[model samples]
Target: MINVFQPSLGEAEAAAVAEVFASNWTGRGPRTAAFEAEFAAHLGVPAEQLLFTNSCTSGLFLAVELLELGPGDEVVLPSVSFVAAANAVAAAGARPVFCDSDERTLNPTVAHVEAALTDRTRAVLVLHYGGRPGDIAGIAALCRERGLTLVEDAACAVASAVGETACGTFGDLASWSFDSMKTLVTGDGGALYVRDPELARRARQLAYYGLETASSLDAAGHSDRWWEPRVGGFGRRIVGNDVTAAIGSVQLRRLPDFVARRRELTELYDRLLAGVAGVRTPPTLPAGHRDSYYFYWVQLDPAIRDGVAADLLAADIYTTFRYPALHRVPIYGAGELTLPGAEAAADRTLLLPLHQGLTDAQAHTVVEALAGAVAGRAGAAPAGE
Candidate 1:
């Protein structure tokens, strides 16, 4: 069966892990630090600005804590975002204000974010939906004007950028994912970046038990009493391990080829599904917008979306929608708000299989199945009607 997300791994990753195993020191160590530095370079940021974490979820939670958000604060984020982003804010005693997104793009516009802002709003967190850097520049400008914090959930945008500047660097703080399914597969890991050097230093400490201690390898490097650790702040041990980092380093080297193949597949899908009945392909990106091509999605008639998806499933072509609208999620307490844009996305959007492993034949098979599904159901009434 075709998968919507799959990691491209092989001998290189296995060999890297083998090396890590042979080294005898596999916790957060030289390999982890090297991976962070390389990733920072990829994002065009200082090495000190990045902190490796266990997962993107951990980075999100760390972002909330580092921002010092609390009960009276409200973090404005796109409704079509990962649950962890909302959970992070809500868990931190801060209110999460869910905003709308463009129906076609599934990313919040600056207007949508501004509409959700209240006097209580302290920060704005937005995901680069499907790896499109949606209005982030304008939102950054808006955040600057309002003196509010901006945190970018760049989990989908490992290689996305407006121009030379990276997507994750636009905001005050940002986080990225490197899980098995993500563009950069590390099995399970993430990283955080803080614009301020001071805050970045503090955040690094906070991730590792908030301790100002001499590391195990270089115990005597810092001071005489290397055994004694100073507990600095309230924090958690959520650092990425050297094993995953080893795999990440190898993956990072091979990322360009992965991205190129995905782009090739994306273009093929666009052409293949161009005229399929009831199908609406993703809109062309604006000038200077470089997509990471993490997810390739299409919109269909909401009434028949589920039916078409079921048909595709039966045909062995996996299809699904990401990010059910967060506002409708009862836990956020914004279920009553009418957000047609986000609602439209939740109802009509379907993500097709667009992973690095997908071949030209696989893509053709998916499009063929999709076309057949839509055509078969086109003449019929909506599923239940």
Candidate 2:
């Protein structure tokens, strides 16, 4: 079966992990630090501004926590994003004000964010959906005007850019994912980029239980004061370790090739499904903007979406919806919120298999399957037949 999501890893990753195993020092040590530095360099950011975390969720939570928001504070974010963004705000004892998505981009625009703002709004969380860059400059301008903090949820946007400026660089703080299914697979790890040095330092300490720094042992590998460790304020153990960083370091080196292949496959899908009726491809990105193509989302008629997904599965081509509206989720207790664009996206959007491992022929097969499914539904009888 053609999977909707798949990770491509090979001997390079295995060799990296083997080196860590041989060293027998696989905790959060030298390898993790090296990975963080390399990743920061890749994004053209200073090493001092990056913080490595176990997952994008943790990075986002750290960003929210840095704001020191509480029950009275509200964070405006797209309701079509992964539930983690809202979960992070909720975890920080803040309210998440859901915003609608733009029909074309499937991402919340500056207008949508502006509409969601209330007197209690303290921050704006923008997600680059499917690795497609949103209108960050406009949103940043609005944030500046309102004196609001901008937190970028760039989990699917590693290496994505707008005119050479990376997506994570536009906000006060941003979180990037290198999970098993993302463009850069790190088993399960992420990084947080903070524009402020103090925030970056605090994030590092908070990730590791607020442990106080101390000097390294002597050259002889012996510590005269082994029991003199210092403790600081309360914190959580949400930092990445050397084991995962080992894998991530190798994956980072292959990110350019991975992104290229995914784009090639996506272009093939675009050409193959250009004329199919009842199916709409993702928005065409403007010039100077680049999408990482983490997922190739297509919008179908909401009434026939389920039928097409079932037909694709039966044909051995897996497909699934991208995201459900966050406000409708039971855990958030935001059912009363009305976000038409997000609700429309939740019902019509489906993710096609677009990864480095997918070949041109495989992409054609996926498009064929989708086209056939939609065509079959178009000619089907009415309900109760």
Against the reference, the lDDT scores of all candidates come to: 0.91, 0.87
lDDT of 2 by residue, 238-275 (tens): 98989899999998899999999988888888888888
**In candidate 2, which residue ranges exceed 4 Å CA deviation?**
214-226, 381-385
- Report the Cα lDDT for candidate 2: 0.87
The local lDDT score (0 to 100) that residue 329 gets in candidate 1 is: 87
Across 227-344, the per-residue lDDT of candidate 1 in tens digits comes to: 7777899889989999999999999999999899999999998888877767899999999999999989989887789999999898888888998998888998885788899999
- In angstroms, the error of model 1 at 328 is 0.8
